[model samples]
Target: MENIGVRAKELNETIVTLRRELHAHPELEHDLPFTESVVVRELAKLGLDELKPGLGQGHGVIATLRGKKPGKVLALRADMDALPIREETGLSFASTNGNMHACGHDAHIAMLLVAAKLLADAREELAGTVRFIFQPSEETVDGALSMIASGALENPAVDEIVGLHTGNLWEGLTPGQIGWKAGPMMASTSTLTIVFEGKGGHGATPHLTVDPIVIAAETISQLQTLVAREVSPFEPAVVTIGKISGGSAHNVIAGTCELRGMIRAFNQETDAFLKRRIRATAEGVAASMRGRATVMFSGDLAAVVNDKACALKMRDIAANALGEEWVKELALPSSGAEDFAYYLAKAPGAFFYHCSTFESSEGGAECNYPHHNSKFDVNESVLWTGAAAMAAYALHWQDRN
Candidate 1:
């Protein structure tokens, strides 16, 4: 195969332009009409074999390209959704639409689109079929499941899959570097809502009230034991209470207190144990007091476990396409969650991370803001690296499989 990095570099300007355009006008969740139109317009120029639009409730677009030879089918995916954050990057193309591409979804879209063009141009050399999945609502952790339910993974019956994320979380990797892992790459995530019910009364008369605020405070303190004492020290588990709401005024004690949080665990056993312990702890703590607690789990995402063979194959392909120095094996799994786990669950595949942080040209501090932060931005220079990696993976996977 020809040097994919060189070919991708030839289209660097185009990739950067498309990324900036996406950054300027960001959309959120499944309501990405404009984003979908932009993707369709760019893909229409590629002359794919088949173009299927309005997938996953009108936000997803799947394009199929058939090669001259017959072989195994492979899928390449990219998410297209922005976070509901006001932009604070102060860039020339910063979004003004009140939504920000804080998680680098803009880069993901641009890189995938460019990869699509590269793959389409080399269709004659490709074997079997390649399905390009442009997914939506990834921030809500339901986009991949939605697309799967809509039959995005069927038809050609993908033999394997590949995907990438652009971010600065892999701190050891510099700009343009790619990081991957063999097994579990990310943790399973679930939202936990615990409500403590108690009697309401004036603050001055605390003896007459059950005082849910006190019970909630105690419950929160006790919940820490679930991780430190209940879960094994070897396994990583996190239980974070991000939001707590109950009281309306200072004088009156509220009848109910709501605690909203997230739970993350790498393995199913650890995850199950955490959930069970959380509920038991909350109920026990509240019952010991005069109040009662209710626990509910929702919006759960499975851990992203990459196939070992697929991961090793990608490492080799990435080294050949982007140079050995640009590829590195990740030492640890990220506690962050991803809906892409759903896709990996359906098919054997690998998910890699692209480092996008670089020193500022203006001599200012490097734009190293983490994902979901208001000021998050990626070094556009490395955008082509991700595109090249995906393109190379697709071309090489068909032959190897």
Candidate 2:
């Protein structure tokens, strides 16, 4: 057996080069021109002629590496778009503009590109076909659906799909360490926008004016109770108001206030129930204060549920290939939502995580920053481990066929 780990060091320089280049030119969601060009150029260098670029419009690319024998098809995905955050890591390759790849999408893209190269090199020995997908807009507009709609999922008819995200959730873990959970791995998300309307009046008005700001505040306060008073405490859920806008000055009583947030849940019933309660609470709170409230469920994403049998098989593959210590059994489900849920919704697959191993003593090592922070940065050494884990899983799945 040709060990995938042994091939890691040989590809380190190329991986670093690719990661740095992408980092320097980060693109926002649904608009990844330079990133796509880089992917096309690299795939061309690997001599994979069956290239299918523009799979999801801006920055998605799909390339198929043929194997020695026909068998089940496997699809691997990596998101290409960066966030609107400005760079603060101060690296030599820090983003040139306001947008940044602060969520480690650079690493994800680089690892998947390296996997394509490695798989291409081993094509003669492989048994099943491997389809490489470079996805776009994962940070924004549900890029997975766009890719699937563009026929990225079907041409090869993948029996199983796999992808990895980098995170700093665990301490003392090695770079490239893999985490897996069956059932609900990530929560479903529903965006809510609530607008409250009241009569505009002077701040000095004694008792004649209905204050929308007060109503908005009351509504925000009452919205918190929906999860606590209505939903089961044992069933974890969250409703967070991410953005609120209303008054422009302190001396004027604002006539309108807008609250934007999302509701997150692990189950369908809980998710639906929360939305119902939120709407009811918003309207009730507004009406009690003689104001009007409008609530809308703007958009949503389903929870990511890993196929139990596939997760178990990948765990065994990781234990065999990367050692027992590399494979972790995750107990708590992730509260954050993933559009990878869209892919899992259509086919059986698993979305895994690789630890971004930033040292705890480092000044910027606060795990509190989370994934979307503009200041967020991840340890880069996990690139090789992530590539190897995906490659190992693909090979093992082929064996099962």
Candidate 3:
């Protein structure tokens, strides 16, 4: 484990090259043929024990490595989907396929690949099994669930799992810093859609028509109170109305108004309470205004609660791989959501963030843009830290068991 830093340094350039290649040819969710091919080709070179391609749709790749002695199985996951954002980074390898790796999944794939190579080379010293999972459609938050349904965590049966995100989502963390939290690393996400139906009439004849717009406005206003009045002060929750559509013409009162929003919470009770309150408030407001309303919920992702022991082990592993100064405990959980939560529900695991922003002469503003932005990019020099951390964790986890 002590040599992990040196090994990561040796593979840094190759990891960066692979990351750039993936960035230039970005692909979106579940439909990554070329990206899958590149990953498969690189993994094949490592001479793994068994390579299983096209899991859960024809994009995910699962590679298994068996050690000389038997112990326990460890799973390492890396997402491989790009965002729909157009590239604005202006880098030579910037994506041109009308999509970009704005969230640094490209770097995740490269780091995991290099980690696999490092582990495969040291197979003789290994103990149990290592499962390398390259998942697709992580942006949509269904890839992990699909992979689980397809038995990505079975066969050898994963004892513990580790995943990392390469980005500057955690504020104040430099490029080499690793952010870890013991519990509730990320929030759950739920989509709430409400439709208000009312009578349509000329705008001038306000008395004859029941305006759904007014009802929608009232509903939106009341929905904000769910977090403030209903949820406990200690709990963290966010209700955001991202889209609203109602009238087509200024002079006409529309018959139907649509409201779409998202709810984020750290626990199931809070999520359920928010959903219930949203439906009741929207429907009640519409009914009182002589209008009808329908509420629909979809795309639910659970919160990522890290196992206490796993999180501590990951912190120690990261500290060993990259100096202790590079590891930092996150003060709070992030409101952002990830599909990796699905995997954690099935196995004891930990998900962490790797600060990918490095100080450059260009300026900090350009290098530290938030994820999902068109200009999002990572400092390639620190890519090895993630690889080394994952490799060290897997090797040490086997020895621990």
Candidate 4:
């Protein structure tokens, strides 16, 4: 096959223009009517073999490009959800709809669309099929599972899968470089919702009142020690109390107090351990304070563990499509979580990081804010590298088989 780098570069402006359109009209989670339409529109022009719409119980689109022969199926996925944040990038194309693409899903959708175009143009000589998944609701951790339930993995039945994330999530990589890891690429996310119930009374009679607020505060403090005291120092974990709601008036003690937070870990065992400790501590603290407690887990996403063979193959293909120097191994696994873990549970796959970060010299520190932050943005210069590498991986995955 010819070098895909040159081809991707040729389509750079098209990719950028598409990304801007998606960025300006940001949407949240699985309800992606506009995002899905944009995806379907671009994919429909390619003359692909199959175009499935309205999967994931909402607006998830799947476009399949079948090669000359029937062989293995490789699915390339790109998430299409934005965070509930106001845009602060101040670019002409920045979203003004109150929702922002702070995590760069807009760029992900653009790169995948162009990559599908690249494959469709050369489908005659290709040996297998490429399934392009434009998924929604990644932030809520429900899109991938919902897609699978809708028979996304059926029909052709994907033999393998792959996805890529673009941003400054991983450090030590320059713009256009690719980051690959063999195992535990990302973390598990578990949400916690706790409520403490007790007797309410007038604030003047402190001794007669059973204060749920005090019990809730104690539970929060104990949760802070679960990672530091129980887990090994080498292992990484996090428990964040993001929200707390309780009393209404200063003169009266509320009957109940609620606390909401999130837990993150690199593996299932560690994640489970944290959950157990949190439940026990919250219950015990409430019981000791004469206030009953209720603890519930709302959602969970497992850690992303890459398939070793698939990872090695894609790394070499990226080195070939881009340059050897443009491909590098990541030193550490990220504590952040992704719902792509659900797809990996169904079949073997690997995730790659496309560096769209800007150095201080290029755009200053402000332009390179961490993902999910209000001011986050990507370096547009290297958008084609990710598209080229993904297209090249789909083209050459059969060689190793």
Candidate 5:
């Protein structure tokens, strides 16, 4: 395979162009028509004109680039949704509307689009087919499952899958630096919402009302102990309650209190244990306090477990293409959840992070904002590196398979 990293510098102009356009018109999950059109048009320019759009109900686009020789199918994925955050980056190309590319999906789309362009240009040098997956709703609904359900994983019969995210966790490194782990790289996520129903009465009447506010408080407190006491310390599990709403008036004993949160765990056993405990504690505590409780898991994302062999393959690619310094053994697990977990379950693959090197040392400008935060901004220099790494990986696989 030709050295893709050497050619990445030439595509820097394309990277900036695509990133700016994508960042300007940020779209939300399942509603990325404008962004999808941009991707489709650009992909068509790369000879992937025979496009398959609306794979995941209006947000997923799949395009094929057949190679000269027959080999296993390789799928390259990029998300196309933006967060609801108002862009604070102040860049000229920042999101014009309330939507912002705080999660770096803008970079993901641009990099992958460039990858398609590179692969298409190298079609004669390629050994196998390539599938470009532009996904939507990765932020909230985890649209990967929908794409898989719609047969995006079929036709080509995806032998291996690859994806990337731009985050500042490894702040000082340059764009091509790869962040990955052998197993359990990310925790599985389950959204838990519990509603407490209690009798309402005047605040002055102490015994007349079954105060749900009080029950909610108790339930949350006890729920904390579920992990500290029940689950093993060796296993990583986190239960967080982010939203709570109750009575409107201070003088009235509220009839209902709603609680919303998420449960994250590295293993399925720990996840199941936490769910069972949450249900039992919420219902049991509410019943004892003269209130009823209803609990349900709203949205779920399975844990991202990188296949061992695939992870090693990625490390080798990073070392060769980016250098030894850029490839490091990532031991820490990301507490966040990703829909890519769905893909790994179907086939052997790995989800790697592209270092969005930010100036974290300068306290005046906090560039390393966590995902889902309104102020999150990514270092744009990594755009070309991510594209190069992905394209190189694909080419390597093409040669080997």
Candidate 6:
């Protein structure tokens, strides 16, 4: 087998080019015609065994590379939707459009494209088939479900799958490192909206009006107890009220108040319990305050759980391809959720992290920005490490065990 790390290094310029091109013209969820065209054009050059464009009832691309020998089919995935944020990175190729690839999806697509190229070049000696899944609407957390529903998993029927995420999602991980965990890499996430209805009146007449604002405040304060007191101390959970709105005037009591928040938990049972309690607490508090409350949930996704064996195989593959020092087992799971959990539900696979943080101590920018930040940027110099790891996994997974 060719040294994948060296080959990836040789293709770094191409990787950077593709990444910049995609980054400059970032697109949002559910409407990514431009993004899809870019992906299809690059993939068309591969001359693979099969290519299917426009999946997910929208813009998702699926390409396949068949090898000479028969073995288990592997799926490599990369998401292709940017956030609705304004770009502030100030790169030479920064997005002129309002959207930004703040979560590093541009680099994800570039690495997977280069990985596809590497596997396509060695198809004669490659074992089994490689399915390159360029997914859309991942920011909405429905893209994976959309593709799976539209037959992205059938035909070859992936025996296992693998994907990677980049940027500063964790601490203690330096640039170029690969972070792997055996199970439950991310928490199940859902958003809750609570609407409190009350009577409108002047602020001076506090006794006459049912103040939804007071009820909303009390609910937010009590929701914190769901994680600290209700859940086990060792279990990881988060209940955050990200947004709250009420009242039009400072001296007027509004007729209604709305609170929007996120619920994150690794345990399904715990997640369910928390949601139930959250609804109950909100309604109960509103009733106690002489107001009516309604609760709604959406943008829900399951936890990202990795197959232990698959994760270990990925660790070994990264170690062999990028050197032992580049591979590390993650100590904890992220409360942040992913749509990739949808793919894992259908197949046994692992999601790995490619650390691409920049540090001022290393003469790089002091960028501790988390994902989805407007100023978030990656250490592009070591991006080849991800391409090498994913490509090496497809080549060596069947033979590794």
**Highest-scoring model, TM-score:** 3
Write down the TM-score for model 2.
Answer: 0.92
Clashes of each: 0, 0, 0, 0, 0, 0
Tens-digit per-residue lDDT, 1-401, candidate 2? 37886686467677878999999999988788899999999899888737888778656888887788778888889999898888877788888699988888988888888888878787777777888888999877578988999887787788889988886654445556888878888899999999999988788982777788899888888888888888887999999999999988877888899999999999889899999999999999999999999999977888888999888878888777777887787877789777888888777989888887665555544643567777677666556778877888877775654
Reference-based lDDT, each prediction = 0.90, 0.82, 0.91, 0.91, 0.84, 0.91
Q: What is the lDDT of residue 76 in candidate 3?
A: 96
lDDT of 2: 0.82
Model 3 Cα lDDT, one tens digit per residue, 278-303: 98999899999999999999999999
Clashing pairs in 6: none
Q: How far is candidate 4 from the true structure (C-alpha RMSD, Å)?
A: 1.7
lDDT of 5 by residue, 216-335 (tens): 999999999988999888888999999999998989999999999999998888898899999999999999998999999967778999888778888888678767877777768788
Tens digits of per-residue lDDT for model 1, 231-317: 889989999999999999999999999999999999888888889989998899889988999999998889999999999989989
Write the number of the candidate with greater lDDT, choosing between 1 and 2: 1
Which 10-residue span in candidate 1 carries the lowest summed lDDT? 358-367
TM-scores, each model vs. reference: 0.96, 0.92, 0.97, 0.95, 0.93, 0.95
lDDT of 4 by residue, 154-273 (tens): 778998999999999898998989999998899889989999999899999978989999999999999999988999999988999999999999999989999999998988899989
The TM-score measured for candidate 6 stands at: 0.95
By the TM-score metric, which is better: model 5 or model 6?
Answer: 6
| All candidates: CA RMSD (Å) | 1.6, 2.3, 1.3, 1.7, 2.2, 1.7
Indicate the residue-level lDDT of 38 in model 5.
91
Runs with alpha carbons beyond 4 Å of true place in candidate 1: 360-366
Model 1 reaches what TM-score against the true structure?
Answer: 0.96
Which of the two candidates, 4 or 6, achieves a greater lDDT against the reference?
4
